[model samples]
Target: MPKVISNTSPILYLYRIGGIQWFSKLFDEVWVPEAVKNELRAGKIQGYDVPNPADYSWITIVNPKSMPSEWLALDLGIGEIAAMAGN
Candidate 1:
């Protein structure tokens, strides 16, 4: 399977619906930026069924080296910034 980079919303919904395993079935590994993981943490606090992102073996958290000023200028959330910046 090819590498899979994911944003936050899809993950949030999938986790809430108990369909997170679909990620594993579709991809050998899933790469999410640190921002995505942070969003997941926020979801967990909101009583969503978000698993601890670090506990998943197939899910890798990557920190973006740099974020473009242009992307930041868009005023998007961290998860959007990370995904757009190719984190």
Candidate 2:
């Protein structure tokens, strides 16, 4: 079994399609950065249909100790940068 670090979109879309259970089936562990969790929470707060990571036992939230300077230069979302940096 392998572990995976996921960003907001994949989890969000999969959840929307009602296939979120596939994550546990395909991977031993599914990790999401704090930024990703926050993004989902924000969406939910705004009245969007978003899945809360805490609702899923398979999902784990992690925060990167530090971000790389090179990655910071790129125009990417916080969740995207956190996912890459956490990995």
Candidate 3:
């Protein structure tokens, strides 16, 4: 089974465009880091129309055990960093 580790933007944009189900259709499992989940939750709290990862059965929330020190030097959002780290 193939899986993909996703960040926040793809999920957000896909959900907005009513294409979020493509994740389940394309991959056996959609893995999301905790940071991605948090970002979506924060967006929802801000009243934006964000889909909750928990709402999708195929979306699995994963917390990376440790992030690479090199990644901390890059200018990326926590969700992106976490997704890469998870990968």
Count of clashes, each model: 0, 0, 0
Better of 1 and 2 by lDDT: 2
TM-score of 1: 0.82
- Predicted candidate 3 versus true structure: per-residue lDDT over 1-87, tens digit per residue: 689999999999999999999999999989999999999999999999999999998999999889989998999999999999884
lDDT of candidate 3 at residue 84, scale 0 to 100: 94
How much is the lDDT of residue 49 in candidate 3? 93
- Clash pairs detected, candidate 3: none
Per-residue lDDT value at 77 in model 1: 88
Candidate 3 whole-model C-alpha lDDT, 0 to 1: 0.95
lDDT of each: 0.82, 0.94, 0.95
In TM-score terms, candidate 3 sits at 0.95
Off by over 4 Å in 3: none
Best by lDDT: 3
**Rank list by lDDT:** 3, 2, 1
